[model samples]
Target: DTRKVAVFVGSLRKDSFNRQLARALERLGEDRLEFDHVEIGGLPFYDQDFDEDYPAEGVALKQQVRAADAVLFVTPEYNRSVPGVLKNAIDLASRPYGDSAFAGLPAAVIGASPGAIGTAMAQQHLRNILSYLDMAVLPQPEAYLQFKDGLIDDEGRVTNQDTREFLEDFVDGFVEWIDRQRG
Candidate 1:
């Protein structure tokens, strides 16, 4: 069966490595997964006051996330944790208590970074938060890609064959994980 995967990229830069990874995952899963890159750039910071009467953009974000069968979080390491924008998006969707859009949703995380750690700490921080959000997370085949220029082409394709194959395998495993969650 086809599944809809909502992709959340942590970086806001035009050519962020995490964004490139997300696009590569989308391309790899083109046949089995319908991927939607949810825009978190315009979302306001999460505040309890806005939970009741959320802004139109926030509402749209919630709806988009809730409608997806699964989530693919592609993030960058920002001071050893997730970026503020991505965290804000998460907090925005999980609001008003017991009405969190992310609850029980199947999710996975992968990240790329310029540092030697390859976003390891950031992904761990995100995984911990996702657990609190009650998301069913895939635990294996974790991707911690090291970033480099020219890794992804203008066409959103990964240039390195080994990296491409690894990502493809990760996508395949994610598909299986989603299926397992459904079952």
Candidate 2:
């Protein structure tokens, strides 16, 4: 069966680079993987009391995360960590204590930033949470892209050849890693 990959775009902006990264991954993996692009925009902050009824949206988000075999986190750095909305969504899915939707899933995180360090620091911080959730993160082919002015065209297609090559390697690595974990 084709591996199911639910990609989470951490930025909600119309032209977020992270969204572009998610799109690029989808384009490359066209047939080999099933991609579910989940949105975090409408999820209200997670609260214990709300678990009773568990609004349809919250339940749907959890189902989406749980149903996927793996995840691709395309995130943006905000104040040296992932954006608040992204974190909120994760917390929402990791609900009811010890029943996290992401538990035992394989995942790869890649980030691009307009600033220098690319999102290295932010990714590390995210690791701490993912670790606690027991996620199996791919260790190789780490992607942290820095500012690349005009590297992507008006259509949001990545145009930098070097970055393009890196992305190719990254996707291949992720597929291989997913196979290994599945096996």
Candidate 3:
């Protein structure tokens, strides 16, 4: 069975490494997973004042997430944590108390960075948030990839054999994770 994944790329940069990583995953999992790239860059800062009447963009974000069979967070580390835009998007989707879009959704987190440690700290922070939001996050085979130039090409192809194999393993794990969650 095929599952639809709402993919959230944490960075706004047009050619961000994390986005490339997300695209690579999309390519790897194309047979079993359909990826929908959720737009978070245009969302306004989440506000409780608007909880009763959320902004249209925020509502759309929540709807997209709610429609997905699973969620994938591809993030970049900034200041040793998740980027502000991603946090804002999460807050928007999980607002208004009992109406969270993320609750009980199967999820996975992965990231790539030029730094040695990759996006470990940021992924940790994001996992904490996902737990709080009640997502069933995958716990094994954590991916904190150290991205080099041309590791993933513009067409979302993994250039190196080892990197491709690792990502394939991650994708397989994610597909199993989703099945376990929904089974």
Best by TM-score: 3
Backbone clash count, each prediction separately? 0, 0, 0
- lDDT against true structure, model 2: 0.86
- Which residue ranges in model 1 land beyond 4 Å of their true spot? none
What overall lDDT, based on C-alpha atoms, would model 1 receive against the true structure?
A: 0.91
Tens-place lDDT per residue, model 3, 1-183, is 789999999999988999999999999999999999998898998889988788888888899999999999999999999999999999999998899999999999999889999999999999999999999999988999999998998799999999999999999999999999999
Off by over 4 Å in 2: 154-156
TM-scores vs. true structure, each candidate = 0.96, 0.93, 0.98
Model 1: pairs clashing at backbone N, Cα or C within 3 Å = none
Predicted structure 1, TM vs. truth? 0.96
Candidate 3, poorest ten consecutive residues by summed lDDT: 50-59
RMSD values for the candidates in order, in angstroms, are 1.0, 1.5, 0.7
Q: Candidate 3 regions off by >4 Å? A: none
- In order, the Cα lDDT scores of the candidates are 0.91, 0.86, 0.94
Model 2 scores a TM of 0.93
